[model samples]
Target: MKRLFLVLALLSAGIGFYSCTPEPHFDNVPVITFESISKNTKLDGFGNKTDSLVIAVKFQDGDGDLGVSSTLKEDSLLYKTTYNYQVRTFRQVKGAPVEISQTISNSGNFPRLRDDNKIGPIEGTLSRAILIYPGTVPKNDTLSFKIKIMDRARNVSNEISTTQVVVNQ
Candidate 1:
């Protein structure tokens, strides 16, 4: 009786696991928005020449295929740009902070990847901490940046920008 019960339980568990199917998490492209930004000095090798700037992004995906596999390409979903903080100004609208458009002469990518190369339906805020090296951005400087994400299907997310984030001393 014990053996039969154990066998039945194992079979049921296997069946349950195999029955689940992967479905599209989103109908179109993933949606992303800016959440917050913070400056931390410890992650920059604990040195004065550089610091780490942490950026938070909120995203939602229906299909959950928001990253490239290593077999296909080198880049992942995340990308970014940097700008001088003084280049743009912020406005107060009904006690809300509004971002002003700015043209940046220099821009680059801040690609991020997933460990497994494959992801399921996901909905949450993702945060990335990038090292602000001397050449990337000057220390003790203020800057703004924009970031976006793309899915494996080439669907891109809405771009979000930080009006200003100060690098730590």
Candidate 2:
């Protein structure tokens, strides 16, 4: 009778452990949420002072193909202009809204989250610093950014916009 009781206890413990394991369910297409945006002052490569807007975003991908290798060459599959992360800047001068031109390159690439070739779900926060020069915007002006990310499979994530931030303050 003791042997049968021990066996049943072990079986119940095993079932409990198995049921506690949680599996993540996410869409293959990437999804992103705006986390935060902050401003800082820093020196540029040219020894000039500049302001930086650090934008943080949380992302989730089912396949985890969210970034490109630094050594990978641009091809038809991944065009030169296909940046993994894209940021569009907008400014409001005294509450008047205006969209910045595309002449400024606010897009860049993020390192791959998973080094292995195997695909799986991934979720993390990505923070990027965008430099703002003296004339980037007027003093005491408010700025905001619209952000999106793309996976290696050319899957574009949902777009998210950051809250307004005062620059040159």
Candidate 3:
């Protein structure tokens, strides 16, 4: 009788353990979108140098909730994450083949959304790439660029390549 009772108790415990469901992993990979790119045409028109290219990115996907970090004073449960951005540029030189050249990196952290959190578009910007090439292109020259985004969990989005643009001097 005692052995039978022990067997029933073990079966009950196993059932209870199996019934418990673990919390879902909140670490979600964010989506990356390249909004627009504008170059300094005025400089290109003249013999003057083309300063830099402006690249913008728009992050999406949070059921209408923005991310905000919580501290000792305020605490809430939401999908919190960080963002990483990478930009690379290549100059199409005449004889030399296109080389994987200039690169820039930046990062930002956005905690879970809260009542007081206020931000726009889930977007961020970077523009430190001023002069891609030291010398100016005598004729219309084309250059290539790539954009990449990563989430807090180290998930990287697919690399995006843009159409080659010719810079006329």
Local accuracy by lDDT, each model: 0.58, 0.85, 0.51
- Which residue runs does candidate 1 get wrong by more than 4 Å? 1-26, 43-49, 73-121, 135-139
Total backbone collisions, model 1: 6
Select the stronger candidate by TM-score from 2 and 3.
2
| lDDT, residue 45, candidate 2 | 82
lDDT of 1 at 63: 65
Question: Tens-digit lDDT track for model 1 on 27-133?
Answer: 55778877988877664445445666677778887666655444443343342222111112333445555544434332333233345554566667767666656
Whole-model alpha-carbon lDDT for candidate 3: 0.51
Error of 3 at 19 (Å): 39
* TM-score-best of 1 and 2: 2
Candidate 3: clashing residue pairs, number: 2
Can you give the TM-score per candidate against the true fold? 0.53, 0.82, 0.46
Residues 31-104 of candidate 2 have per-residue lDDT tens digits of 99999998888777887667888999999999888888656776645656779998888998657757787557
> Candidate 3, residues 6-80: lDDT per residue as tens digits?
999999999999999764323245565566666765445555665465666555533324343344123222222
- Model 2 residue 21 lDDT? 59
Q: Which model is ahead, 1 or 2, in terms of lDDT?
A: 2
Best by TM-score: 2
By lDDT, the candidates rank as: 2, 1, 3
